[model samples]
Target: MRIKIKKESCTGCRLCEQICTIWHYKEINPKKAAIAIEPHFPEPGIFEPKLCVQCGICAKECPVDAIHLEGEAYVLHADECTNCGICVEACPIDVLYTHADVPTPLKCDLCLKCTEVCNTGALTVVRRSD
Candidate 1:
């Protein structure tokens, strides 16, 4: 699974962030969500979803070797992770945001919650074309 974001369509309303946090953690806080919408202030209007590119930085930086490829997805074995924050530092896009209430890193599952709730059709999930 993969995520696709249309930057041109996002409005910075952050409804995507609201639904993401609620869907994953039963919370309304955007800060707790794995997905992030960054505002490009003073640029008229531009909101871009900082998407997880499924790069293996988290797996590589995991000192405990807890992160691994499971099918097409990168999963964290919660029991094995030490929450060292190494993965967070390793990510080039900084998409590996930490869970607010947990020490472990959070990754996008590509489950389509963001896509389903995108009123602007800005986010999409697809089978990897490759």
Candidate 2:
């Protein structure tokens, strides 16, 4: 599964980020969330919601084999990660990020928790074809 972002529909309210953080970390921290909303202020203001597309780029770039595909979701093996930051660099959309408190990388797990709280329908889960 992967998340489809509607950039024009996003209002910069950060509902998706909030829900993601709360669901995964049990907190209200936006920095810990898997999804990010980048805002372009002044002149033409736009809210760009960036998220993982589950393209497996990170998994293929992992030198330590820390990233793997489990079913349709690409997950990170924290214990095996070397904090190389290769996954973060490998992400084409720049959605993968390093944990603030940990040395490991973090990406969207396609849990669909964020989509549940997104009132604007800016975030939607796309199921795998297979």
Number of clashing pairs per prediction, in order: 0, 0
TM-score of each: 0.88, 0.90
Q: Among these predicted structures, which one has the highest TM-score?
A: 2
After superposition, which runs of candidate 1 have C-alpha atoms over 4 Å from their true positions?
Answer: none
Query: Candidate 1, after superposition: displacement of residue 96 in Å?
Result: 1.3
C-alpha RMSD by candidate, in order? 1.8, 1.8
lDDT of each: 0.80, 0.83
Candidate 2, position 7, lDDT:
84
For residue 22, give model 2's deviation from the true position in Å.
Answer: 1.7
For candidate 2, write residues 30-116 as lDDT tens digits. 788888889998847988888888888899999998888998889887789898888898888898976668577767888888888
